[model samples]
Target: MNIAYPYAVSLEEDGVYFVQFRDLEEAFTQGASLEEAAFNAAEVLTGILAYRLDHNQEIPAPSAAQPGERLATPGVEVQSALLLRQARAGRSLSDLANAMQTSWPAVQRLENPHHWPTLKQLDKAARALGKRLVLSLE
Candidate 1:
């Protein structure tokens, strides 16, 4: 699934551009310009997602982009972590580790936003979850 979240950008009277994600209410930011707002949006989105993952909070799926709304994607490491967690579903970490023939901590790292798993490791994790890893440029 595409990991891009849709966010609305508006220019306030103070000339700063404000960004807010409908799906992630806690993720919002402002910047001096539209470009900066877009940049900050991605950073804030990544941070919020990382926080949710670390806290074991719910991570809502991204809603479809509405007209005039742009997409903001978190960094690849966070995106990978999100996908791994989602694919794991309700399965236990120990179970996944056994399936991957790796240690529990290694499997746990697959879902860590700060831990960058190698492509081979991701592929193995996906296979263990009966899913395939698909990469895209956009």
Candidate 2:
């Protein structure tokens, strides 16, 4: 379940680099170099998702990477958001709260990208959702 987003990158006439996610209309960022642009892409994607979460907006599913596009993999905060969203599909907050032996507010906070949840807490949430939390390094 890699939630990496595919984005188009271009060089502007002013020698600035631009990155945009076709799936997310609100996401766009610029940088002076490709490395910075790529970094900003991840940051922008995370920010977009966080904003949506904060405002209770719908989060669109990430599309597959096509040819000639860069992949912007979100950090742990965004990844947690994805996991929590998937875990909540077809379920109720009370159900999850009961499964995790926590309060509804706590469960909601767990899904909040602005909140920093520990891996242990995430693992517990995964188990409550009948999923396992796994980690890998590249």
Candidate 3:
């Protein structure tokens, strides 16, 4: 599914930052660096989407990735990469869970747009599904 929600990012203080999405409230964080702020914003967006899904609530479309934007947070990038790799490798969620000795729900959470798994967890999932986690250097 395509997501299209618009968000604005702003600095609130020395280390604090805020990300505001349309029709959604605001999310804040105190990152040690600018990159860290963008990264947290991605996770914040992921968690918000997951909450909306878990509660069967309405979700807003994904917003465009602004320049200097983390684009897709590392966590989200990991999640998306795993799913695409598994799909291309002919591996299903069931296959992954069985191999990893975990519940399919765990796999489900990793793939679901709503469930933004931690980057560490995403790496494990990618490995479990016979996929390798990679980050492209720009």
TM-scores for the candidates:
0.97, 0.94, 0.44
Q: CA shift at 29, candidate 2, in angstroms?
A: 0.9
lDDT per residue (tens digit) for residues 48-137 in model 2? 888887787887888988898998877778779767887679698789999999999988888888888898988999999989988877
Lowest lDDT 10-residue stretch of candidate 3: 70-79
* Backbone collision tally, model 2: 0
Q: Of 1 and 2, which scores higher on TM-score?
A: 1
**Displacement of the residue 9 alpha carbon in candidate 1, Å:** 0.5
* Selected candidate, larger lDDT, 1 vs 2: 1
Tens-place lDDT digits, model 3, residues 16-55: 6665554457544435666776666667766665565456
Between 2 and 3, whose TM-score is larger? 2
Model 2 earns a TM-score of: 0.94
Q: What stretches of model 1 exceed 4 Å from their correct place?
A: none
Model 3 residue 14 lDDT score: 68
Q: Which candidate tops TM-score?
A: 1
Candidate models: Cα lDDT each: 0.95, 0.87, 0.57
Clashing pairs in 3: 3-62, 4-61, 4-62, 5-61, 5-62, 5-63, 50-114
